[model samples]
Target chain A: MKEGTSISVSKLTKRFGHFTAVDAISFDVKEGEIFGFLGANGAGKTTAMRMLCGLSMPTSGEATVAGYDLYKQSEKIKKSIGYMSQKFSLYEDLTIKENNRFYGGIYGLSDKQINEKTEFMLHHLHLEDQANTLVKELPLGWKQKLSFSVSMIHDPKIVFLDEPTGGVDPLTRREFWTMIYEAAHRGTTVFVTTHYMDEAEYCDRVSIMVDGKIEALDTPSALTRQFKVQGMADVFVQLARKAKRSDN
Target chain B: MESIQVDHVDKSFQSGKSPVEALKNITFNVKQGELFGLIGPDGAGKTTLFRILTTLMLADKGDAWVDGYHVVKDYEQIRKRVGYMPGRFSLYQDLTVEENLSFFATLFNTTLEENYELVKDIYVQIEPFKKRRAGALSGGMKQKLALSCALIHRPSVLFLDEPTTGVDAVSRQEFWQLLRGLQKQGITILVSTPYMDEASLCDRVALMQNGSIMKIDSPGGIISQFQKPLWAVQGDNMYQLMHDLRHDSRVDTCYPFGQYHHVTFNESTIDIESLKKEFQQKGVHSITIDRTEPTIEDCFMELMNQ
Candidate 1:
């Protein structure tokens, strides 16, 4: 394992019965680096992400996350990573404070630590007075922002965000990226997946998956230049349009 | 005559004790055979407005008409003339693709054979999976089935709610092309999406936020209304560049856009050479700055701030 690499994978593969969901893929993410994992729907991104997060086992691969072995230390890897998805993360029925405490408990934090962190998070989000308010009562943007904050309650070494700004407004989407940049600035590795090509440009480095393979991996500018495209959107379309697999 | 007309529509939902306003004085009109868009984020009253126009729900204190029929008084007439595809996949999961299409055709007192020409372009893509259950089909295939069902009735006006939401870029482009084909057939299309980029695809768009309409104009019209001189700035260190630009006195608003930081100056014009030299003095090197045109998103943010 490299000294500064947060995640290192060599020829990772996952197969489902007769289908090779994720073909041999290799990549490395450095500490505090913003890595964009991009692909079209049904491009094996979710399958590959599941294996990296320790939620699923890879059929064939050598990988380490946060200095822990992918095969031997899957349990430890889970504790050292934070994850949030646009579809589900925070409990809508729970109050903001309660949700924080619940997640903190799940991460095995002590009650005292949970209390302190919850207060800090509430203060940062400017929801100190509304801590008791139900998450469903808050606006969509606030809920998404709060969800990102709570995902970091344990202050894990790496955070995985799945389309975190899917349907957010333009202004709030920019704000969410700022939050992401701040997290990376604090030396936490950020591994994010998004459909918005514009968001892909914000990544320090990006890897595009096509039909279960890492078709392209480079900085946004390099990828654009290599593809002879104008922006990340065109680069994405050129690669994704040739995909043989149907959309999932 | 307008294909769709909405006049001061308002709707509120009971969250707990107090009612949360979902739509506030929303007014817009879609011309005949025009492709109009309702562009906004989630919870921006788009679905509420769609429901009212489709005659599935009523507004609290306003009127709307679809296909020249009053939404309230002529709801039955409106329902018969409009084809609505809700955001969520409303088809039966257990039903096969073919079955769902036929079911929808039956609801409108029509048959697939009768309207084959109307949906041939979209239906043929999903024909190979006709025997497969709708739930078993892929996202793109499922969307095709839903669109086919919506067009089965061959209604004069089509209402699609966030049809491209969560869809990938390639599929979204294909879907829009299908819509263009429908428009050529003289169908008035009204669609909603959260993607600001998609606004440019429409003939005109109504930007909505916080239960209110911000502006209604052609995409080009909105861009022209943006009177600020914008610039795209990039440097080796993006985070530091953003920090330095935000703190600059002459810079108005700076936000991270795709590959560069989009900046608006308080003054109308900026000295490019001086700005580069000034950044060098601040120790921000490898600076690349150029004047850029305002996109729909830039216009959207400007209107939102106002």
Candidate 2:
């Protein structure tokens, strides 16, 4: 494992009855780094992320996240990290500030801290104008942005962003990534999973999981150069094509 | 005459507390047999405009014309002339692919045999799954089925709103190919997508944001108008390179594109050799510098900032 890594796994496997969703995957996520977990739809990326976030139990193996043991120290891990899934996971009926308060309360933040954090998120996301608007009333992109900010209301050391920028415009996606980079620079490690190969290339290091295995793990340039490809899309294509060949 | 025109169109919703403006004076036109695109983020009035043109919804103020038929006054004619595939897959899930095609054909008082040639190329792929439920098929299949259904009526104009959002890359490529094939048949297409790369596939695109057109032109024409010198810079320390370039006065905008960071410099005062020296000074080696062209994303970003 890398020194002072925030996440580590060894022989980590997750299965549901006959189907294995995560199969003996081992990787380390360094502190204050942006680690990308890439996979197509239904490629076990979500399953693996669930295991790491202590939301789901692994069928077997050892894993540590945010320096908490995956098996016994799940609560500590949960408290130390933030998670945002494909679903907004925010209350649609509640106003933007109310949703943040709800999430902040569940994460066990003090009322005062929640208020400060709520204000910061609202200001940072330019949501001050829409703070009182119901989340459902807001457009899809703003809802996504607010949900992402809500994920970190409790001030977690690490954040898990799962396709956070899906279906957003390029300008919004760009601004969102800028916020992610800012978070990383402030000593927070970002563990994100996305289907967008181009977004994956922006991560410091990315791992492509296919059929419950980390088929490739390297920096975007390193992987692309090693695979004799031009971009992350080509690298993923080549790897995915190879898997189909093996299956055939 | 404009092949398609929306004259001062406006739409509003009763928000209980107050009125909300969904669209405001949204005026634009597309030429006949010209592939036009409505490029915008979700809920940016692109769908509102499309719905108005397709005769699904009405505009509160002004009117739209498809193939010279007024949208509000000549609703039936507008419907007959425009093929619309909504952003969401609204096909009949229970029906088979062939049944869905026939149903849409019947909507326009037409038959499958009357427009079989119009949809044959797309229908052939799903022909094997003619009996399979539309819901049981894959995303690509579902999209193909939807497209075939839309074209079954032989509309002179087509409209697709963010059609490739959830589909895979391969499916997106194939969907565009099908659209291109249809476009060559002398049908005008107005497609919208948040994906900037797909912007190039359209003959002309109107970059819409916040219920307004930012820029409208051919994809190449728009990209060529990007006002900066871009370079793809890479080195051992990418993380640091990105961080450093963001604060560099010489670097106007630096975005991580694939393996390298695409950096743009102020066109009036760009010093490439000095920038290379600065990169070297930061312990960044293996720095390869080259003039990079602006992509649709860059163009959209520029347009948005403007």
Candidate 3:
């Protein structure tokens, strides 16, 4: 563990049966830094993220998340970090207020704190009028925005977002990134994965995974300069095109 | 002759107590062999429209035709000629890739050998694992299998709904190239996507919002119609810079673009250097501003604001 380092991984790897999903990879994320985890389909990004979030065990490597050891304190790591993915986050059947309160309770917040936080979050999102509205009834953008807000109800040290802005409108997508920026500004380290190359530019540093290995890692500008490419999209295509594990 | 014709189509769904309008007076046409795109986000009625045209669902009002056959009356004809790749992978997961393709071919009374050339380019990519179950395949491979199944019958019209929604940039580009190849083969393709960048790939795109068509034009035509002076601004502190720009009188609209904040001004003559200086004076330093082209995303946001 190092001072001001929110996450540190040294040769972290995950293997399944005969296949090495995530080969030995190493990276460090500073506190409050927005780290972009990028990869093509079946490039082992999910496998690696699962290990860091304590949802899956790493086969071999040393890592620390939110000041907790990756192996010994996985439960503690789970408590100190938040996660939201596009595929699943909030329960669609639950009302907006209920979803917020439920997540707050799951994080072990007191009843009084839950109520207060729920009100503050609703007010910030301008959803006070729709507090009792079921999440399924909300628009796609509103649902995603509310999902992110609920994930932060407990104020974890680091938040993991997996394709958080997928399918949202262009404007709403930017608004979602603004929320991410605000969260990082408040000292919450953001570990995010997105398919959108433009979003990669917003990250302080990005690591691109190819064939279970981190083939490129640097600031966006540095990466563009190093690859001699016009943008992150071009850089991504060039690197991801060489991947051998397209079959998953 | 038009490959597809949608006339004043309307559809709605019953949700709880009220009826939600999924499509309201939607009308559009795709010409023969033209690569038309339905550009929209989720719940924009793209899937609803696709269903109506594919003869899987009927509209409450108006009529549509595919390959000169009525969507409702000649649904059998429409179904025979149209190929649909749904947003979700709706294939037999338990079936192997080869099995799925062969099953679809059997359904259309055709053999794999008969239509091999149609899907060869895409099929060969996944052919190595022809024995692999569809469920075990990755996202990209699954999509290819689905497309192969959709094209198994060698239909005249292809309807792809958000085929590139969650796909990566590289795979998405590959998919579009495949669509272009299909178009060159004289197959009229209708595809929908949430990514604004993909709009440029379509010969023409219809921007849909809230169950209504916002605009329909070529990507270049749409961008040319952007009636604003757009500028790309980059500052050291983007969060603060955005806040300051939004409140400033000079900035009419501001949105975060890649590596820069795209700010638009009402004054067409708003000089870039002067705008940069004004922001620098407001304690926003390390500023760089340049005149930039309005992308489909900018045009989309502009249309949304209106």
Q: What tens-digit string does per-residue lDDT give for candidate 2 at A1-248?
A: 45679899998998888877788999998888899987654567778888889999999999998888999999999999988877778898999888878888898888999889988888888788888888888877777777777887777888999888776877678668878888888888899987667788889899987777889999887998899977888777666644331110
True lDDT of residue B127, candidate 3: 91
TM-score per candidate: 0.98, 0.86, 0.98
Task: List the global CA lDDT of all models.
Answer: 0.92, 0.82, 0.91
Write one digit per residue (lDDT tens) for candidate 1, span B1-306: 899999999899999656899999988899999999999999899999999999889899989988889999999998888999999988999999999988988999999999899999998999988999999988788888999999999999999999998888888998999999999999999999999999999999999998999999999999999968889998877888898899999999998889899999998778888988888788778999998999999999999999
lDDT of 2 by residue, B78-160 (tens): 87778889888899999988788878888889998898888999889889889989888866677778888888888888898
Measured against the true two-chain complex, the DockQ scores of the candidates, in the order shown, are 0.82, 0.36, 0.81
Q: What proportion of the true contacts does each candidate reproduce?
A: 0.84, 0.39, 0.84
Ranking by lDDT: 1, 3, 2
lDDT of 3: 0.91
Q: Which lDDT value does model 1 have at A231?
A: 96
Model 3: how far residue B97 lies from native, Å: 1.7
Best by DockQ: 1
Considering only N, C-alpha and C atoms within 3 Å, which residue pairs clash in candidate 1? Answer: none
